[model samples]
Target: SQTIHQWPATLVQPVGSPLSLECTVEGTSNPNLYWYRQAAGRGLQLLFYSVGIGQISSEVPQNLSASRPQDRQFILSSKKLLLSDSGFYLCAWSEFVAGAVNNEQFFGPGTRLTVL
Candidate 1:
């Protein structure tokens, strides 16, 4: 029984401020973790991913960064937030599937951030 959790369900920050969002997974080991963002009424955009501890892959060149501090914990951070950074941030985890080409991902409830 794997579970993922995200904190500070909603956030409001001024432009140029720093940001930090946390995610944690329980009941799993070495699972692939992902960070995605979705604008209002738009599709999801993958921001970062991790295959293992200390291994991260960024999918886009943006003002955001992610880190795996522990086996079950992941964090997303930004040194200076931008106006366009306002969106829904999601954290997801998935395990490798033996037969399926792509693993099925399970997502967290998500955190909504508003920049002003």
Candidate 2:
């Protein structure tokens, strides 16, 4: 069975503080990974994604970065946190199928970040 994991179910941090959030998967190999941020009562925003180890793609320009050091490990980091960065961060994984549409993604419980 495949599973996704995220750390620190919730977080409270002051503005300008550094941040590091981790996500990892098990029971899968070379899965497509994604990072998303959802604001209160808003839709999700794709932050980053990776197709394989050492391959990362940023979906939007922001104050954060992502890395895939291992095939099943993804990390999101920032040197300085911003108030606008506060949101529900989600990590998801899906099977990679070439030319496939609507791949179902399994999401982690998510980490709620509150920046003050």
Candidate 3:
């Protein structure tokens, strides 16, 4: 029974402000974590992922960064938010099954950020 949690369901921040978003998982151990962003009507874009604690992989170069301080915790941060940073941020987790063809991920209720 794994569950992922994301905070601050919605946010509105001025441009150039700092940003921090958090995600945590319960009932699982050493699961693969992921961060995704979805703009208005676009598909989910992979942002960052972690295989384990202190291990982060970025899928694309962007104005944001991610960190994993613990096995079940992941954080996304930006020193200065940009106008393009506004979007829906989603956190997901999947079981680490070796050689598996597909790892079904469970996603959290995303946080909608608006930069004005």
Candidate 4:
């Protein structure tokens, strides 16, 4: 079975601080990894995605960046977290099984972040 996880289920950070959140896959290799941010009551905003190691795509222009160093490891980072950066963060993945990409995605429990 494949699974994804994000750390610090809840975080309280200041207006500007370095940020590092990690996401990883356990039973799948070379799966598409996505980093998304959802503002309160708003929809999901794709920050970045990786198809493979060192390959990343940004769906939105903002203060966040992502990287896939290993086939199953991904990381999201920020040099200076913005006050507006406060929101929910999610990491998700689907099986790389051929023809499986057409299926709907399964999401994990989200991480709630509050910044002040």
Query: What TM-score goes with each of the models?
Result: 0.94, 0.95, 0.96, 0.90
User: lDDT per residue, candidate 4, 1-116, as tens digits?
Assistant: 87777786888888788888888778777788888899986999888887789999999888889989899887888898889999999888766667664845556666787878
Highest TM-score against the true fold, candidate: 3
lDDT of 3 by residue, 1-116 (tens): 78899998999999999999999999989999999999995899999999999999999999999999999999999999999999999999999987886989999999999999
Number of backbone collisions per candidate, in order?
0, 0, 0, 0
Q: List where candidate 4 sits over 4 angstroms from the true fold.
A: 98-101
**RMSD of candidate 4 to the true fold?**
1.6
Model 2 lDDT at residue 9: 94
**What's the lDDT for candidate 2?**
0.95
Order of candidate numbers by lDDT, starting with the best? 3, 2, 1, 4
Q: List the candidate numbers ranked by TM-score, top first.
A: 3, 2, 1, 4
The lDDT per prediction is 0.94, 0.95, 0.96, 0.81
CA shift of 108, model 4, Å:
2.8
The window of 10 residues in a row where model 1 has the poorest summed lDDT is: 95-104
Clashing pairs in 4: none
Assess the local accuracy of residue 59 in candidate 1 as a C-alpha lDDT between 0 and 100. Answer: 99
